[model samples]
Target: MSKRRQPSPSHPTTHHGDPERSFEPYKKAVILGLRWSNDDLDLVKPQAALLETFRIQCGFETASLVIPSTSSEEALNAISQTILELRQKYDMDRECTCHMATLFVIHYIGHGVSETEWEFDICGTRRPDAVRIPWSSIYIGMKSDVLILIDTSYSGNFLQPCHSLQRILQNNDHHAEYLFSTGNEISDQNGPTYDKNNNFTTRLTDLLYSVSPTPVTVAQLHEALCTQANDPSTKLRYTPQYMDCYKPSIIIQHVEKNDYIWKIENTTRKAQIPTGRALISVCILGNTVHGQVKEWQASLSTMDSDVTIEGVFNLQGYSLCLLSMPISLWNSFLHPGYNS
Candidate 1:
């Protein structure tokens, strides 16, 4: 966790640490997907889906649901319940040998305001000022790290989202880190191009699910997010910021090697494949090349095809090994049928 600064003209997407597939430090994780009520906040569902996919791939077995919280009451209740659960888990872990930290994730998607201050636009009727959730209450009582992935422009600073978030974290007490998209408010006036998430939501999920079975670290995730933000074609107003509340890369997720197995098997592929791997999609974590690196991994999966894979992997025959057993079911698993 470092202080905020403008990203360099050229920051390589390659990571420089050795991370494992298992989300070690954090033994348990809870993803609370806040489905923002505003129609313009479509990024909510996909944001939740990315984390839900990451946790499951990281070998975590939890019964948490990733559905959007419709009303403010539902949102607050979900937040309360999540914090309480983390507190209990933290207390219980204290008594155990493997006193691992718990990862509390909150995916907030909707019309968020940071112009005069920071808050989420729940509904247009009272959108800008009505429903404001204090930052402290968001993770109160929890004794572990909190990772909040907000899909909103100007999350901390309405016009200067990064700077606002920086000042807030400078005086924050909780152990947390946030990944926010830097852009203008989403309204009828020059709103975000949600159509082809090839640059945003798509990259987000791909970055996490890149190396399945192999753990993906927070640092690595941050690097990928930054890479996308820095790219000019995305038309992002500000460089996406990855600010931490004094924590480390703890949460990790692993998906699969072939047949594009993962992230709500039925999850739709709204973006075109960015690699040359034919219909098969592979996410390269760490370095973009095949080399002997400690933090190297790739999570491969197909988006719209249900083809049978009859391949034999031999570690002796190749540098990378395939551990698709865990996600073998996901290889051909069906996405929970949706009406989209």
Candidate 2:
């Protein structure tokens, strides 16, 4: 007779190779500041100042500042040149080696009519009504991991086309890219105010500074700002909104062991005794009648030996054994429930 072989281990295993860690060299950050309204230069001034401070604090290997025409025709030409330079440097052309480490920080501090149109002063004249910052334009020559900050009316509407937090989490690319907005619906007609004590940009700047030691997720930042804004007396309300609309059907390329585990949990069911039992019985059902017959006979094998045959047969109906496999084999069996 042939000897039986023990089954191999069923659990998935992972091997971590030799650890080779290296720090990423300092990257460049391009700051695009668009402050169109002359109504509150004070409110706008700090935004630009905060950007400069953020750049200095980041200590990047390289940085560029682009301020479009907030005042004159000359400003328009400057803005166009700056935009062109940025496009050439970071756009998909791959012309500049610096492009790989570049992070475009487009800051729009003006007024947005809706998701599509932003009214900003290209020149001091304010003759040109509203310019559209197409989603294509925003992501032009950059990686998908860009960080965008817009402080304007209807800024929240911009996220109307991006993916939501729930989708992002489920899809496993929660950190692919992020968008941060200062208000919801639309900027209040009451021009942005700077409460000498605290302002939106300043508070955010402080938060970023504090976040150096602890990396903050986009969701965490949103929650923190919301909590502060809810308070009644907080000098400057920081209303941050995450763009949850644009569901680009791109399959996230990067995959980690954790990502697979997360996907399995979202897509599969937890192991249960009844489920396991059902699966085992189903698999063995067709193999032999002997086990089924024995199970039936055992059900009739009651404690009371004195019980009559009729009584034993009656008890047999209630004595059926629900077979179950070991917990390790749960994944190997067929799924018990409905399919997606």
Candidate 3:
């Protein structure tokens, strides 16, 4: 797909104040799974299937293509053609009242080079048979939202070093650009076994399924993957990194959940909308006493009135608090013993 220039800002779409109506804009979803060899294709196939199923369930007309061979120029051409057809089919170029209802999900599992030279080589060599395509060559224009999951050696190279969270929050028509990767370098791939179930895609798919029945955003998915990576049992080598600029946030999966309350009835829980913003998780080491947890939450909230405790959960013998704080306090908050 040819890279196009950014378009002028369009009118803000009105969603009629209905939360569910926000997701109704998406009409079509295209999933492209790229792999190097037949062995990798076998794995990519199932992963693509899982993604396709999720997209379909989200009420979008979905199409999936598992393109094999890192060396085949034909494969690249196929991807380009598919993107072209998608643009035409969705009338992505036309400036309508709403953003284009097209979601592009790409999964690339192969060997990648540095960030500047963001190219994938079949055998990591510049041989005649090996096809090396730069990431810039791929169509990542501003027509639709894009989610790229890369499991390459230097997959983290795809990420932008810094992002503007405020821009994402303010811009209503801003289509998302999300990149989730294994790690930046080979050393980031730690641990022993990197088998079928232990690889990045496997762990990703697991979280995708586990978070079902609860609509999950890219930020939530990345946080879940990081939790899995820290766990020794999951066998996930590298911690995944996410780089996104999504307005109103992008929900990758949508599943219906019954609204039921138990003993905590008539009580309202602050809905933590994961906007893929600046959220930090803090762990407090201690018992599970309600008073103690409340004290910690109070102290943190007192320090910065703007700070919002997104979620609180216990894990690995410690209580964790997911906090949304102003960027100004990030330096002090990130330092060790700052709370103490």
Per-model CA lDDT versus the true structure: 0.43, 0.36, 0.48
- Model 1 segments beyond 4 Å from truth? 1-16, 20-25, 37-40, 61-78, 85-99, 115-130, 155-163, 186-201, 233-238, 251-340
**Per-residue lDDT tens digits of candidate 1, residues 80-196?**
776576566645234211235556666655444444433333331224444544444454545545667655444433334333544443345335566655454545466654333
Writing each residue's lDDT as its tens digit, candidate 2 over 1-340 gives 0111222232111011100111122134455665543423344565756566555544321233434434344445554576567756645233223224344555555434332223211211212343333222232334423445555433323445322322222233232234444333223575444242354555566665654433233334444555566566774544444432122111111111244231111112211111111122221222333455465445534422221122111132243233332222222222423111
Strongest candidate by TM-score = 3
TM-scores, all candidates, are 0.54, 0.43, 0.56
Off by over 4 Å in 3: 1-25, 37-42, 66-73, 94-100, 115-129, 140-142, 153-176, 183-193, 253-340
lDDT of 3 by residue, 57-100 (tens): 44344555544445457666766787777667765554333444
Q: What is the TM-score of candidate 1?
A: 0.54
Task: Quote the positional error of residue 206 for candidate 1 in Å.
Answer: 1.4
How many residue pairs collide in each prediction? 15, 11, 0
C-alpha RMSD for every candidate:
15.8, 18.1, 11.8
For candidate 1, give the lDDT: 0.43
